[model samples]
Target: MTTREIVQKLWNLCNVLRDDGITYHQYVTELTYILFLKMMKERKQEAAIPEKYCWDRLRALHGEEMYRHYRELLTHLGTEAEDELIRQIYHNASTNIGEPKNLEKIIRSIDDLDWYSAREEGLGNLYEGLLEKNASEKKSGAGQYFTPRPLINVMVKLIDPQPGERCNDPAAGTFGFMIAADQYLREKTDDYFEVPKLKPFQINQAFTGCELVQETHRLALMNARLHGIEGKIYLGDTLSSLGTQMGGMDVILTNPPFGTKRGGERPTRNDLTFVTTNKQLNFLQHIYRALKKDGKARAAVVLPDNVLFQEGDGRRVREDLMDKCNLHTILRLPTGIFYAQGVKTNVLFFNRGTNDTGNTEEVWFYDLRTNMPSFGKRNALTEEHFGDFIRAYTAEDRTQVKDPRWSRFTREEIRAKGDTLDLGLIADESLSAYENLPDPIESAEEAIGKLERAAGLLSEVVEELKAAEGGNRK
Candidate 1:
């Protein structure tokens, strides 16, 4: 079977699981557990798995017995396995299936597939497709972790991660960035993992990441191992003081969670000069700080409009970013491409800056969002969608492009505009239709997100009012 066929066959089991009250997110996680076991059994990596709880042992059982054994196997792997990959895959893992029949059916379905052909056809694509399915289903807010693969491909392509150089995603979501970088290395270099002699760093320490959420972290680890990349992914908060270690990375790519930190709590990390409740800004601070300051480090990050325009700490963080790293390219992304509608986002691509003169002299702005078709399931984002923008991404003079969607702004010019990177030269024709409106669901989600943010701010106001009242009472 082809990758798509394998994805379809595997994904169809999600329906049977749904009847058992298993969510789309839960179904995917469960599939990862089973799929890994099947693959391990196929590869016959005996050292990786204990003999008693092997795939064959679980497959031989029936009814509740099989379900019981499978549960035990997952538990055993979670706590007892010697292989780090196996251990990570099953860490905190539990079966979501409530029925033995459903469990049996899923096992049979997976067993029936042509693994030999599917392996050759590409299991990485198959698993990623499953992840995309779970993301598009809008389960457990999986969309937040799921950066569109097309966008990922473009970012990875732009960075062009090299062998032996460290690549990382602190907010690793599904570990898509690391996986894409790995694939890029293999294809572009025609280099296998065990190629023309491997150094220790090149083999074991090539790519790494840190994820706050355990479920997504587990998925990312499984994703990495399935692709034959032994990437180090830690399970911890990336924004916390004790979060993943910073600095020394050659390339960093990430899309941190959008929204403010609850209760206006900033990270305990004293390393960040300008602290704020804004999660993206905090991640932005960490990304540049994590980069090597010797001038070779580069990064591409996805951040919301608030980072570009908001004042106070937002401005401070942006300034820090500009001074420390080259805020060279900002790609205005189209709306509806994300699950959260109306959240205008942009990708900031820049390399680390070393001198007092500043690294970004003139920042290039590409307005891909303006007048572009709303990106959604009906009109999925693809490489072709980014064709024009990719071509516009040039080392040549900005005037040479002649594309109206492209423009450039000097650092001084940006500073004159109150240092707000929300600079756009062309007014989008779509702006006029603001009153005509967006889809009802999209509009509702946008309204909810705004209301939530406003409520958070209002709480701060309430506290301030109470503090004033107490002062007057005193």
Candidate 2:
């Protein structure tokens, strides 16, 4: 099925529970559980289920009998799963939006889907649309699971993942990077290309991920499986697993969660070098330790600008990163790019290389913030906005790059500045002056200039509005 068709079908069913105060996210989650159960039932009839579950016997009953047994099965399944995440899935599904009429509508809508066809075409698109709608809700805070698809595609293209290379996203929300990488490799290699030949190890062959949210993790698994890619995807905190070595990786693409420090139960890890509440720094340190020297490991980290210049342990971590690895590129992201409102973020790309005791050669910086044409809560971050970054990334050429969108800085230039501040782009004199503009000289001169400009702009706006009003009246 096409993306629109799938969206329309699911949306029609969404109305039944809209009155239950079920958010778009909750509706999608409930639907996901029911869909999984239905598919498992079908899979069992075709082949033996890998484990004993209600789905294995869900097909036995029909009509009211089927509904009764299904509800009972869900309750039983909720108790059987040991993982809190799994338990939550069944528990949430069994209670919320499971009113008889709503439950019947959900089951019937899910039943309408031909599992075989959905397995082939609709699954990935369906989940993607669900993610988009959920992010737009702006309440569930599930938007963190979604990175801009265009941004993800550009990063995957720049990294240019090869078949059989072990790719990972430690903060794999909805598995966007994994999906993009798999699609990239599939397109580049021919149909006859043997995946096994690309790598001898089959079981550990493809992509892997770690997601903290259980629902997101479940969606990530479904996302990967829909694409026919297979491997272990754990539902756990990536920061906890950071210092513990996983050998190394070829490419790591992630957009870790962003926000001010909030209290939560912290996970224990023995390998962490720095103990601070700053999660971004902790994740960066983790990625540093996880990369293999000379393995051509490159990562695109999404973080707020505070990590670039924050003092104390945050600044210390940056110093350590600069000394240990090659800090390559920084893409200054804009305000509305994320579902999380007013968030200022950037993408830091670096290759994990040998500890050669030399400063980073040239750090490429792309100022995409201003160049972007359209941005807002709903209509934000399209692929077009990222086109320049993709081209300048030079993924296909790999070496001998040229014509970058923004300028590159040297180690000396960075060192001259305090804390290697990744200040936003500077091009025009007016804008650059504002960024580097000194504070008012303990006088009102600078303040007067600011007020004058504000007055001038307001006057211009008033005149324009008057003219438009005059025309409308005529």
Best of the candidates, lDDT: 1
TM-score of 1: 0.90
The digit string of per-residue lDDT tens for model 2 on 153-248 reads: 887877777776678888888888888887787677653165646643322456887888877776776666555556667768776754364447
Least well predicted 10-residue stretch by lDDT in candidate 2 = 437-446
Q: In model 1, what are the clashing residue pairs, if there are any?
A: 247-290
Candidate 2, residue 210: lDDT: 80
Q: Tens-digit lDDT track for model 1 on 130-231? A: 898878864445888899999999999988888778999999988999888888888766665446565456547888899988899888987887777786
What's every prediction's RMSD, in angstroms? 5.7, 12.4
Q: Predict model 2's lDDT versus the native.
A: 0.67
Best model number under TM-score: 1
Task: Tell me the spans in candidate 1 whose CA falls farther than 4 Å from its real position.
Answer: 192-195, 430-474
